[model samples]
Target: MRNFQKEALILSVRNTGENNRIVSYLTKDEGILTSVLYGGPKSKLRSLVSPFNSGTIYLYNDEAKHSSKITDFDVKKYHLSFRESLFKTWAATLAVEVVISTKCAGSPEECFVMLNGFLDGLDLLDENQGQTGLIRFLWRYIGLLGVQPDTTNCQRCHKPFYSGNFSQNTLQYKTGGVIYSHSENGFVCTDCYKASFDNPERLLFSEITSKSVVYLQATSMCEPSVSRNMKLSDDEIASLKGFLYSHIESSVGTKIKTLHSGIGIL
Candidate 1:
């Protein structure tokens, strides 16, 4: 058996047989890990095993059963700020849920940094911001996963998109993702959108919203604190949220449960 200790953020915990519990952690060393905590519910470790808690945990691998055992843990931060408001709680939950749902292909350092940073940002965000931080986090996370849409060029024509005055309402979405226009029944350039089809009644997006997405794509590279300063209108926030969540759903191949719980009272 191999034993080690690492800093970890609790993703979830569930009661098991007797007083035991099953705990899932996003760790600094091992990434996403699940272990059986003996006498967890009745033990002193119970308080440290719940969602969004971060700390160092001691674990040992049971090579024969191919599992890990959680012997004890030391709590670093409970992130109690999330409980300060329903929006905070739900947004924090959404972050945790996304982390849980994501499948890691390499080192989880990036995922851990983003998730931990997002939780900290939520704890500090103003209540009036709605889910802006959460939305930005999703956009940044999508970019990290390499599934972000490219809005600078037409997917169909391969030319630099010229939005000009109608930047917001001009962008279109079809099978291939966001396009410069709704020409050729999908993502195409302005000429294509204008030239194809006799009827021009099928506009797929609005102005400010698509612009917000473009802004987010640009902001995704900034640190969370810097990105949080970018103010977005209500309509822009809505559009960005829908666009990001839809992309996340498609990439993760499953609906995020906490997201369906609604942003909660805000």
Candidate 2:
């Protein structure tokens, strides 16, 4: 039996037999992992395993079986503020679902930090402001997961694009990502922009949305405190919500049920 301890954020919890539970968590050093809490419902550790709970966790690792068990944990923050309203809870749920759906590809530290920052922001937000934080989180998470819209070059041509040279920008749904043009209604790589004549999947990202995404990325890459102050227009917010959700749906090949049910709330 090997043992270790680290600070963790509880992503979710599931009851197994009687009182025992399987708790899933994400940590900066350890990626996402799950461990069984041996004690039943009455165990102190069970309640602390609630979603969005941040705490230090001790574990029993069985090297022989390549598994781990949560022996004990100390809850640092329970995030009770989210429970005050449905919108807050749903926003938190969406954030958690996004984390659960997207696998960690590179260093887990960035993703962990993003999750913590999202929760911290949630703690101080009201219904009207929560959506901005959630949208910021989704964009930052998409960037972390490495599926964010290509901003530099054409996905098809692999050539650099200058804003001054392009008159329009459009996001390609099929192959080419973002495109820019000086004369064309849709500015993409010259190759794909022309290809759109036959391919109907390409859609133009409105000027407000394209600029908003760039602004969101710029601020998110810096301090969360600064990102929290970021704002979006009604149209920009709606467009952004569609864009991020579409990206996630495309990646997972399925619609996020919560996103549909909770539409217009944010």
Query: Would you estimate the TM-scores of all the predictions?
Result: 0.78, 0.75
Clashing pairs in 1: 183-193
Q: Which residue pairs clash in candidate 2?
A: 19-41, 167-181, 179-187, 179-188, 180-187, 180-188, 181-187
lDDT of 1 by residue, 63-177 (tens): 9989898877888778777777888877777777777777442548888888887887677777666478777788778777776656555555666533432223343322222
- In angstroms, the error of model 1 at 234 is 1.5
Global lDDT scores for all candidate models: 0.67, 0.69
Off-target runs (Cα >4 Å) in candidate 2 are: 65-67, 150-199, 202-211, 220-227, 264-266
lDDT of 2 at 213: 40
lDDT of 2 by residue, 1-266 (tens): 88999999998888888877888999898789898887766777777778888989999999999889988789888778887878888888888777777655465788888888889788887767776777788877767766566555555676654343221333222233344332332234545666766654444432223455444545545555555654567776776677667666665556777788888664
